[model samples]
Target: MPTGPTIIGFDADDTLWHNEPFFRMTQERFAELLRDHADPDHLMERLLEAERRNLGHYGFGIKGFVLTMIETAIEVTDGRVPASTISHLLNEGREMLRHPVDLLPGAEDTVRQLSQTHVLIMITKGDLLDQERKLAESGLGDLFDGVEIVSDKKAATYTRAFADHGDGAQAGLMVGNSMKSDVIPAIEAGAWGVFCPSEQEWALERADPPVAAPRYHEIASLHELPDLVKTL
Candidate 1:
């Protein structure tokens, strides 16, 4: 095994930039729009259920999320949700898509510094166009050696990504906020997994940390990443 990772993969969403908070804000708006039909807590539960069910069909991203919200609205209101409410949900998604890419403190600097030594790749799963747009707007696009906007972050996906980057699993490292999507999968694939917790987390992405995993590491923020990678 390599002394340290030869190729480091970063999860684009919450790991590097602001993401879930926007979704949360949108969800709040959605709840307000449907307040008369259902209690906020109940509506949120239904919306989450709709999102979970639609994941297989639409995958993850703003578009699927918006559709799920619409579905939830229709269901919660018994198909009586007004067209105006549906339009509001659609507009919320549009606003989210147009939201600026706000890089977490030190995210850009860390990537830039690491790119000078090791191969840096972005391993994010979401709507292709939206992810691509964020990447382009982030202005750190040139620093990444490769980009993988996958449908899911499974072990097989990480293995393939590592291989495609000219490295085996043991020579790769994955850094992200979600233990479920970013850390556990990479660790299962024989790569080192670094958990960098984000301020906001989606319920679906939450998972217990793999504390027993020898290759698993956790950092408070992206700023701590460079030092951790150096020790690896």
Candidate 2:
């Protein structure tokens, strides 16, 4: 009956299109705006701390990042950070929101080809509206059988997603750049996990991969995905 993955999960953001570069650009601006209060290195550290601490409250995406930047600015400056710096940070976030979605090479083709044989589910975590906007703009939105913009990627999340959308986790596969969020959780949920490393991923997303897992796999990029899926 089932040969390989009947349900394929694709991670958005860095996997489908460009994402980290915008965040990096905004971080640069954030550091420049706060240069007077803290050096770039120290300010970035504080920003990261704020992001890590605020994830539970803010969840994820541009809006939360802006809030973290503003919070970090006030903290690093001892509440002396100027309103103009805060305003600049806000504008930078808006720019990130407005940035065009640039799909990774062959990302569309891979999704399209796979959709011919497998049910494709987009499982990504971020601000709901922002994720929707990016997907709508990327033109790959119509290709996915279903879309899931969850708050976080966990084993339970993948288990439910695969169960609802396909035969079950055993017949599903998750492909993404994050070892922590995409690969690890999918494998834990009993689906295949395909690691597609991007040019740059967030430090928080890094994890020692599940190399010993019989279902775990690593690919150079999303372009390699369709062929690999054929073998799975």
Candidate 3:
């Protein structure tokens, strides 16, 4: 018999650990390197646009980002960029690979406590290899009974995930940083959605507010979740 929520889905990137900060850092460096010729904000906008367009093709993660940077460099520079720019991009890619993996303040412990009561699932969208490595390194891999690495998070993604976990839409809750990808979609699929806002934003386009949000709740920290679940 299910005691708490039957299924709990978590977003892995910024929700689980530090993700966007690294991207922002890399972007800033990219801008500084190209500041002599181009506007940083415009360059960032272009890069983000490219990433959005390529979401289906490359998915999310450092590798896709690196590729986008390379492509953006080529496009913006019209192949006039020197070898040093290419080398800098390559070095940044390597740095992304080497960045330390640190779990969010309450992520590990919160997951541990929740795992004991509910069926925990990690439903993240990103590059396959990097996500796998992060999960393995985060030391929370075994805590989740199910792990899903998806290319995108939408209504379809959540619907498939809920079905796959045998939750069948009932007693399902999604916890994550994005209101667009995680909260709205999961709630639309007949699951409860808990939005935990992060400092970083995921997409260039924001998700429209749900027409009906009876099952949606937003919390500040993961530590507050277990208790909230008990009340729901």
Candidate 4:
């Protein structure tokens, strides 16, 4: 494999490390707390609805997650919830915050390999402090020459990344699990994209399939990336 693009952007959450499982654990505990007031499935649905609606107001991270649990408790329990339950919810949210970070298998090796031939950047979106902490703990922080931890990975971010990094489209590629956030914007900005799907990315966060001649490649694993890069 030969170098495909000079600059390759990788997503950080589930794409590079373990993330969604912690959120799912918190949600399950939330349902348990509210089970007396509502069915578990109904509680989950309502909680998800609140999260979607509150994303604009609260954004992502522990703060938004706490609000979702509080709001869900009030809604399902008709504001009659025990004070202890609120305490429990807060504790759970904090526990979510303290969950130890771990990287996906082979992430370090794959990133290291890709870095040998191409410039590597970590392009991730999340609460600033939490994202930074995770990156620091991953032990691959030094591997990335540049890191873009933004609130969103929209078209403008991709454009800036390309322009700031090098000459133009030919030099950049975006790789990640979310098609919506990672691939589409990169492609729209005239950069190549590599899609590596994860089981738990937000469905709405996915990018639609390319409408024009393909400017992206879909891969199964980061370990397969060396071969992909060779062909690029």
Candidate 5:
């Protein structure tokens, strides 16, 4: 464990549990709901645009996504969208909120094992209430030394989090699916950044890997994390 991190941070959503796929499913339903108004590909583009525009206003989470869907629906249909369609979208959002948390393969075991030697923290960005619910449902809440639910992930954010919770950013490592929100910024903040790519990543979270960084690492699954901690 020589030169190992003093703290390890994990991202929620698609990192530890199934998330993007629910959004994907809901979006597919949305496209079907408005199929008469626009083609599926074009509708997806409009929805993506709406999400980009609305991120600052609504932030990230199911709530923001659902709102963006409604906004996109209105824009694409020129405000002629039926009230019933809107109602159906609302129900879809509610269903997503109520969806059971499904932990990713090896997620629970990874966290449980790492929590033994390192000060483990869950640093994620999303709706506060919804995130809290997922963590509670995840049954791994007690394993974490800390949990940070922030509006966004940035270099300053990781610096503050690791400083407050452990030795500092220099002794921290963040593992997650997003190169943008999880890996790049954490490395920029002076912590090790481990990228564990997810199956259903959102486009906004995609970014080029920090291939030349000394502290950057990539693993195909959470199953590889413990050995990573040992080596680092």
Candidate 6:
């Protein structure tokens, strides 16, 4: 194994920029739109359930999320949801897709610093077009050796990403906010997994860390990453 990770992967959404907040804001608006049909809390619960249930069919991203919201609205209203309400939900999804890419604190500098010594790659899961747009807008695109806009983050996916870009498995390091998508799977694939918690986490992506994993690490922020990587 290498003395340290030769390839570093980053999760793009909440990890690189402000992402979940947009989704949360949209959900709040959604709850208000359907307040007449159900309590906001109940509506949110239903919407979350819908998103979770539809994950397999729709995969992940704003497009899938919008579809689930439409389904939830119809389900909550017993198929009586107004056409205007549906239109509004679709508009909301468009707005989310158009939302600006706001980089997280220290993300750019840290990545730039790490890129000097190690290969840096972005491994994000979402709609490809939207993700590509964000990367284009982020101004950090040139910093990466490669970018992997994946449907999901699994051990196999991590393994492949590493094999293609790095020395493979033990020579890779994955960093992101979601423990489920960024940390565990990478660690399971024999790479180091570093968790940098985000301000807002999507319910579906939440999970407890593998505390006993020797390569699993949790940091307070991306600001701490360069030093950590140096020490590793």
> Candidate 2 residues 81-165, lDDT tens each?
9888888888898899899999998899898898898899999989898999999999998889999889999999999999999
Error of 4 at 172 (Å): 1.2
Give the higher-TM-score candidate: 4 or 5: 5
**lDDT (10s digit) by residue, model 4, range 1-232:** 3445778888998889988888878888888888889999888888889988988888767778888889989988889989999999899877877777888876899999888877888889878888888989888898888888887778789889777765555678888888888888888888888888877776457557675636778888788877877776
Lowest lDDT 10-mer window, candidate 3?
202-211
RMSD in angstroms between candidate 1 and the native structure over all alpha carbons: 0.9
- Cα RMSD (angstroms) for every candidate in the order listed: 0.9, 0.7, 1.8, 2.2, 1.0, 0.8
Best by lDDT: 5
Question: How many clashes show up per model?
Answer: 0, 0, 0, 5, 0, 0
What's the TM-score of each model vs. the native? 0.98, 0.98, 0.93, 0.92, 0.98, 0.98
Candidate 1 TM-score, true structure as reference: 0.98
Q: Answer with 3 or 5, whichever has the higher lDDT.
A: 5
Better of 3 and 6 by lDDT: 6
**Cα deviation of 43 in candidate 3 (Å)?**
1.3
Kindly state the number of residue pairs that clash in model 4: 5
For residues 1-232, could you state the per-residue lDDT of candidate 6 as single tens digits? 4598899999999888999999999999999999899999888888888888999999999999999999999999999999999999999999999999999999899988998999999999999999999999999999999999998999999999999997998899999999999999999999999999998888888999999999999999999999888877
lDDT of 5 by residue, 8-83 (tens): 9999999999999999999999999999999999999999998999999999999999999999999999999999
lDDT of 3 by residue, 38-149 (tens): 7998898889888888777887788888888888887788878778998999899889877878788789989999899888899997778788888999999999989999
Off by over 4 Å in 3: 1-4, 203-205, 208-212
